[model samples]
Target chain A: MKKYSDRDSLLIFIVLIFFFILFIKLMYLQIILHVKIDRVVKKMVTKNNIENSKRGDILDIKGNILATSVKQYIIFLDSKIIKDLNKIKMILFKYGIKIKEQKITEFKEKSYIPIAYNVNIDIANKIRSQKLEGVGFDVRYTRHHPEGKFLTHILGITDCCGNGLEGIEKKYNKYLLGSKIVTRMYRDGYGHIIMQDKLVDQSKMCGQNVILSIDRNIQFIAEQELRKAFDKYNAKKAICIIQNPKNGGILAMVSLPDFDFSNRIKNLKILRNSAISDVYEPGSTFKIVTIAAALDMGKIKCSDSFYLENGKLKLGGHIIRDNHKINGTVSLSKIMEISSNIGIIKIAQKLVKKEFYDYIKKFGFHSLTGIDLIGESKGILMNLKYWNHLTLPTISFGQGIAVTPIQMLSAFSIIANDGVFKKPYVVQEIRKVNNKITFNILDNQKLGKRVVSYETAQIIKKLLRNVVESGTGKNAKVNGYSVAGKTGTAQKFDHKTKSYSTKFYTVSFCGMLPVINPKLVILVIIDEPKSNNYYAAAVAAPVFANIAKRTAEYLGIKKDKYEIV
Target chain B: MYKYFLLIILIILSIFIYLWQQNTSIRFAYKVSNLQTKYNKISIENDLLKLKINSLLALEKMYSIADRNGLMRPDGNNVVYLN
Candidate 1:
């Protein structure tokens, strides 16, 4: 202090200057970077949210709900905010929740931690009332199919984020799942957090509620009948489809063993829609298409007759035989009634192989039915270029080719609907949430193409009716209405053995009613029945009869012929 | 003159305080109203979802399906188990 030299004073001034610069820098940070720093700090303290919109409800035609969503809370813990670990543990234990030590240790370093998800409102309220600090709850919407086991393949399911995971849910996910909105907020001096006014328009964002063409009662009936057949025959799988032939509206489509929408599926294979997804050699059931094609081409008249080749006809290396081989010539109508394999082969030979192949293409075989569904299959049909002499003959008798249950039904629908084949659809309309405004009918434009003459269709229907009355399909005959349909017993091909497995059989029956003027067409399929009966008449015919009879009566379609048993 | 100046400053300060309080109360009232509306909306939505769930998962509906189809509860002897 005594040595007051000029240099010393200069040094002290220099130090003061340095100190002033540091002070300026501090002020700059506090004022200039205040907004950014505040944001970072708020991010550290504020609650984060993953936004979601209300999911749409799937409804039957009668306004019955099939699927909808409910808000479920995911309880979490902010490890940093939790003042006492013991307290959090106590609250968790009270709610029957357990926290492993490893989880707690792992999340101890994290600011936010998830403890449990999908807790119901009651438990969420109880947790909220505890008012424990650092405990957070995220309210999210979860999908729930109220009809847990009914229409599982159609209603489909969604993921935790409300994304459609399967079925119609997957097909129309975007239309069914509306838009989600997210907002950030922070507490003020009074602990009331004000929202930033970037209001999202959520009204138009939520998925529009869909109304399906399915009637709940009709679906129930179809499912019940299918299930009874499934259990009675000890069938490995079963499917039933009910449709309004006039507009190609699908009323009920059930496949078993169907999964409960509410339960976690152990095996996903069972979830497949067998009616549209799985293809089988249609067997005798496919004779309908071959006959329809033959009739449409005018290659053979309804009165056309063919010799049965004396019960055994050699076509290439294969021998074709009938179930009830009548060793004589039969009329075209009797050919259908007896299901003569040789008779169909003879008729198929009438068309040039190219014409026969083209007719098969026209009937939508080896092609999708364009139905409103997922996982549709176009069954295998070799092109005319690869057609061998045996190919045409075998295919004529409903073998050496594959077709889905839906394709067969749609083909028959063309005949039942008087030749105008309308594409099948499941969804009917979309409705708004706030108001009762229906948006639009699903695919309002009709896609119809005439595939057969009205006269040929009428003849085919009569021939089918006779099959139900006194032929192989007698089990499918209704009490009051004259039913027309065919029975199919197909042998499934074994991949490893490279031959057909007699142990595995696909039994199916497809039919329409009122013979002259059909209103509905029903198809039932039973796969791998183990009840010691492999015939379609024993396995699938009764199922079709029950579903058709009850369904026709339910629709209040009066019988044309009032006959008592 | 000193006394008059002091009185003017006091009047100005009092007016400013009154305005600030009024603005704060209005903002608080708006927040409460908004929150109340949100709560009401949530309640309505919750009710609607509940009704939909009930209608879809009704026992009568399931029973009708079972009855119409002829499905019955499996007997102990008929039930098969696969590993």
Candidate 2:
């Protein structure tokens, strides 16, 4: 009996040892695999929330903030923590938050609930004053354009992630979107905060700030004058550009029917930057190029004369007529003054089609101005081989081709800058957020290239000055400044009719101040003026005069001659 | 020996305090630099506001303002201009 009992006791001991080993194995697995398995589970269940960085500012030359980002708070609730639901509702009602009891009760089962979004500091302060449990706030940055609708198309706006959607904002998106900061947070088993990371100042991570060449006052004046002209004429659109003739710095550019940057533009057509994006037949404005080409090639002297056909000429199965039909043989100066199509056709007939076409190419037509704006159209220019006899004659009178407004302005700038063609630029400088001026020294200064011969440019300037003083552009004369410019009244082609429309015309004027040594070049275009007087001299030239006068006065440019109102 | 040890301890404490103050000043300088950027932005905004006000009061702008806002001359005789 004793031996049997001893054997049974030993079996019991063995079973007890087996059970102890199982418990020890479970403990080992829990200790060794706990962290790894838990990490995977947390990743699957908990979402990693990302905080978007605030967008950098668009500033004026003087560092005045044109656009900026301000901090706003999103009010949230963890309804599970609300000890008194009715009290919380009452408190929210006082702050104009409108939190319903039913919604709060429903949210009690959830971990978190969003009550209000995008509230400013004042509203946030009021909510915080209540000191209610379960109430929380998450911060976000909202963009504010301080200049209101000023320079709207240029400054542009951003999307939710701070991506520039258009204009300068779109042009320099990579430079303006600052680096985003990422952080991780974890909750304990009870959903209580176990770890938290501090917030980062997004401004520190922001990219370099851009300083535009635009002067705020000049922009204001241009917009004001262009708006007035647009309203007065009841035109479809108006465009004006003010540029520094020295280095191609576009000081001010306005394309009316311009959209306000802050408001959501309902008509997408208004967002189109007509100045650089739209191409038009330059009409008589292209005469500057024709004459310049003729002068450049030494084919005709400024005093040379040609017999103009009596009011009409047949070419390319098309009839060309002068708005003012002068019947006599006119000098080169007279042809320009009268804007005679026959006179230009007579001269253009002497040159080979390739020479004239090459000259057109040299004038920067059918090319992008590379003005640091996106979606620039390099206007349509037929290849030299594509030019027919008719093409040459028609192109001489500023037809059968298209050019952007910016290209035209750059061409004028070349004439104004003593024949040196400078590439137009909008951004003048870039500086870091700190007080250090990046362009403090000489080496950091910006520079440009020369485009034409100073002598040829001077000759062209003299002729253009005559056009303003005693010719077609006489209406564009400023009282004190010797204005040099050309007037254009081009028929806007109707695609459906496949011919120029009688009623639709683009009337334009391009002007340079102090003609002998020009400082500023201003261009104004009024589209489809309703009044019977749709001539460039009457509709567009006056707008140019007002902009030039106001801009000159604002810039403190001294008048070389006696002034008048 | 004990007095020498105490003196050594005092010197180390003084050195630590001096180093700590220097470190704090460097931090303060960094903060000041950050604040100055914000201040500069505000200063520019204030200047812009002042310019806007001045422009609104300028002769030409004021004339337009008066014309638009219905605050024109009480009578034709009340208007005056100096040549």
Q: Which number leads on lDDT? A: 1
Worst 10 residues of 1 chain A by lDDT: A193-202
* Interface DockQ per candidate: 0.13, 0.05
| Native contacts kept, each candidate | 0.14, 0.00
Quality class of the docking in candidate 2, CAPRI style: incorrect
Per-model TM-score, in order, reads 0.86, 0.77
CA lDDT of A46 in candidate 2? 46
TM-score (C-alpha, index-matched) for candidate 2: 0.77
- Worst 10-residue lDDT window, candidate 2 chain B: B74-83
CA displacement after TM-score superposition, residue A174 of candidate 2 (Å): 1.5
Q: Write the per-residue lDDT of candidate 1 for residues A1-565, one digit (tens) a residue.
A: 5777899899999999999999899888899998999888787545454467778888899887778777778888787778887887888899987767887788776866888877777787787898989888887877776666789898877888888878889887877887766755444556565443344555555677888999988898898788887888888889899888888889999888888776778898877888899888888888877788788888888887789877888867777776666766789888888788888888888888888788788888998888878899999998778888889888887788999888989988988998878888888877777646565444553657999889888888888888888788989978777899999888888998999897899889999987777888999999999977689998899889888887877776767776544
- Give RMSD (Å) of candidate 1 vs. truth: 7.3
Q: Which stretches of candidate 2 lie over 4 Å from their true place?
A: A1-50, A75-118, A131-136, A183-202, A435-451, B1-83
